[model samples]
Target: MRGTAAADRQSRPGRRALVAADLSMLRGPVSGVVVLPNRLVWAPAPAGRFDLDDPFDRLRVYEIVLREAVHEAELRRWLNGAVLVEVWPHLYLPRGVRQAWEAIHPQLAVVPAR
Candidate 1:
């Protein structure tokens, strides 16, 4: 599925400011989560998939997954065939999810990995 609302929301000023503020929280170039207008983008490998051999080839798949046990089916109708995970919400490690957390709180986010 395409993220039209995501593209549109990025252009707005208030949302842009929020994005900027969120971006500022990052220590350096990283692969984690980005909260856009209506969607969430997760980048697991910020280094751009070092596991790949060809650099130019290989799918830098973000997976757009949710591993949490409870909110699996109830989360989304638009997202089908997406990965799912089960993790304790507040007690989880601070990876890139911190940024996503701010944007989504208890709601599941649609992270767009680049």
Candidate 2:
């Protein structure tokens, strides 16, 4: 059952955070996994704080915006300057997770720092 579930998750473009282990993977070295008190969320770069005009500054504010928006308006704002990656999990993940993911991924495509 675990193997089947894992395979299903791997095959799907995105999977819901239904299990603790899967939630852990959501916390793993993968960009854009947002974890709230009760659920896990993931959003592509432009979809969440990753789309902020200034990601380094006002991070908390951006996070608040992400929790509020259920669609792409917020993301669209940042699309011009940000890369459109997979909108996997619908919110921003923790800072450590994002940092770790970036370390391993090393963004092959360069994004000009504002």
lDDT of 1 at 24: 19
Best candidate per lDDT, number?
2
- What lDDT does model 2 reach? 0.29
What is the C-alpha lDDT profile of model 2 across 16-42, one tens digit per residue?
A: 111111111221112343332222135
Q: List the residue pairs that clash in candidate 2.
A: 33-93, 41-89, 42-89, 42-90, 42-91
Report how far off residue 89 is in candidate 2 (Å): 16
- TM-score per prediction, in order, is 0.17, 0.22
